[model samples]
Target: MNLFINKCSKLHETQFNLETIHSLYLTREKIYGLNKYIENNIG
Candidate 1:
């Protein structure tokens, strides 16, 4: 039972990491897009 719980916790941690990474990727993309828009407007 303890081993099963440990495995479950590990799986949950991996899922959390994926979510964090995904959000960071999305934020970076948004920043890059905004920068491009600003450059276009200024130039």
Candidate 2:
């Protein structure tokens, strides 16, 4: 039972990490798009 619980926790941690990475990637893309828009307008 303990081993099963540990495995489940590990899986949860991996899922959390993946979600965090995805969010960071999305945030980076948004920042890049915003910068491009500003540059185009300014230039």
Candidate 3:
């Protein structure tokens, strides 16, 4: 029972990390796309 709980917590931590990284990646892509749009439209 103890080992199962530990494993479950570890899996949750890993999933949280992936979500954090994915959001960061999405934010960066959004910024990059906005920059491109500004450059193309303004220039």
Candidate 2 structure quality by residue, lDDT tens digits, 1-43: 9999999999999999999999999999999999999999995
lDDT by residue (tens digit), candidate 1, 1-43: 9999999999999999999999999999999999999999985
lDDT against the true structure, per candidate, is 0.98, 0.98, 0.99
Q: Please give the lDDT score at residue 2 for candidate 3.
A: 100
Error of 1 at 20 (Å): 0.2
Model 1 local distance difference test score: 0.98
TM-scores for candidates 1 onward, in order? 0.95, 0.95, 0.90
| TM-score quality measure for candidate 1 | 0.95
Query: What range of 10 consecutive residues in model 1 has the weakest lDDT sum?
Result: 34-43
Off by over 4 Å in 3: none
Question: Which pairs of residues clash in candidate 2, taking residues 3 or more apart in a chain or in different chains?
Answer: none
What's the alpha carbon RMSD for model 2?
Answer: 0.6
